[model samples]
Target: MLTKRIIPCLDIKNGRTVKGVNFVDLRDAGDPVVLAKQYAELGADELVFLDIAATLENRKTMHKMVLQVAEQVNIPFTVGGGISSVEDVDALLHCGADKVSINSSAVKRPDLINELSDKFGSQCIVVAIDAKQVEGEWLVHLAGGTIPTKINLFDWAIEVEQRGAGEILFTSMDHDGTKAGFANQALAKLSDIVNIPIIASGGAGTIQHFSDTFIEGKADAALAASVFHFGEIPIAELKKELKQQEIPVRI
Candidate 1:
């Protein structure tokens, strides 16, 4: 069995790490470089640095900050936000991002997924889908979840996979920062439809929530923000507990 991964997400705005509930009312978490080093030292399987406002502000990811954070961590690092073209991915990769995640851009130009996958290889591409349940239908949202779209969540997941995306980072807009648990049903459905790994994000409150997403949701990895950022859950302890529960994880 493949080991389930525990990833810490650093949501960045104005070059600072921040967290919020349902993607609003942001608060400072810490410096992205500092947090990345801490998480890497704490045994995080991977680190995700998202320039959360890059797309909203109409700019590319901060390469200087990315290089700073990259310098401090030895683990696999993934960077996202305002990444649209081959040039963008190339730049981030040169900055030491092992994988580059594209969200709004992938939705706006579906071909971008294919192009990046072909140029950088599928293992280097992750397509992030931000969606929320509205009137019982899960619809995709764009630009940091500020704009709603008619795109159905599951349908888009399937398309991204077909377009050669290596993995899917699905963040439930309804569950983000709630700490109640992850949107496991949606995650499980995504796992069922796609062969690529699924990284579950949002609503990770407790250790049980992490286990639930992996076992019940059938996710390959679980990514959380506030829980990890606020010291609500330490990566080492979480992995120890998950190991006790017989979940495969690198300790």
Candidate 2:
């Protein structure tokens, strides 16, 4: 069995790490560099740094900050937001990002996924899909979950995989920051739909939620923000408990 991954997300805005509920009402968490180092040393499997406002503000990810944070940790780092072309991914990788995540850009031009995976290889490309359920359909959202689309979440996931995306990061707008748990049902369905790994995001409040997402949701990884940012759950302890539960995790 593959070892499930625990990832801490750094949602950056104005050069500071921030967190919000349902993708609104942002608050400062801490310095990205400091938090990055702490999470790496604390046993996080990977780190994701997203410039949450870069797409909205129409700018590239802060390469200077990516370089700074990249210098502090030895783990694989993924950078996202305002990344639309092959040039942007190249720039971030040169700044030490092992992987690059694309969202709005991919949705706008689906061919971007093919171009990126072709240039950088599928292992380094992650497609982030932020969607929320509307009545009965889960529609994809963009611009930091501020805009909704008619695109079905499942359909997009399948298309991205077919385009050569290595993984998919799915964030549930409704479950985000609610701490209730992850969208396991949707995740399970996604896992069945795609052969690529799925990283479940949103609604992680307790350790049990992690286990549930991995087991029931069939997720290969679980990513969280506020819980780890606020020290509400320590990475080491969470991994220890997951291991005790017979979940495959690297200690």
Candidate 3:
């Protein structure tokens, strides 16, 4: 059986890890490097470090921060935010990022996905889509889920997969920070449309939410932030619960 993964995400702005409700009113959580090392030690399957201010601040991911965290953790780590060109992907890889996640950049230049996939291999390329429902239609949003895109979520997902994205990190803006549960309906539809691994993000509250995400939604992985960072859910215990529930997990 294929093991399901549990990933912890760090939304970094100004060098501090932050979390917010529905992607607003950001509050500081802690230092990214410190928190990242803790998560890795806690047995998180993977870690995502997103420079939430990178694009808006017109800067790349903090090289110093990423390098530090990469050195501190033994687990696989992915980095994102303001990754535009293949050169950007190369820089992050050189910084010890096992994978590079592209969002707004891929949406603006679709070919960048193919370019990175060709240069770094699909396993090193992750396409993260921040999407939200607008007027009853699930639309892809960009720039940290602040701008709406005309592209349909399902179609864009397929396009990225065709472009060789190894994984799709799908975060529903509506469910983001809500802690209600994942957007299973959308995630299920996306899983049917794309063959690449899908990491369901947002709306994760308990271990049961993780179970539903993979078993019912057909997601390859589940990603969360506050629940893990704030001691609400521990990865090892969560995996134990998932195993008891007959969910495929690394534990």
**Each model's C-alpha lDDT?**
0.87, 0.89, 0.86
Question: What is the per-residue lDDT of model 2 for residues 121-192, given as tens digits with 9 covering 90 to 100?
Answer: 999999999999998899999987889999999999999999999999999999997999999999999999
lDDT of 3 by residue, 192-244 (tens): 88889999999999888899999778999999988887778878899999999
TM-score of 1: 0.91
Off by over 4 Å in 3: 20-29, 55-61
TM-score winner: 2
Q: What order do you get sorting by lDDT, best first?
A: 2, 1, 3
The total number of steric clashes, by the backbone 3 Å criterion, in model 1 comes to: 0
Residue range 166-192, candidate 1, lDDT tens digits: 999999999986888999999999999
Q: Candidate 3: give the clashing pairs.
A: none
TM-score for each of the candidates? 0.91, 0.92, 0.91
lDDT of 2 at 136: 89
Candidate 2 yields a Cα-based lDDT of 0.89
Superior by lDDT: candidate 1 or candidate 2: 2
The root-mean-square deviation over C-alpha atoms between each candidate and the true structure, in angstroms, is 3.9, 3.8, 3.9
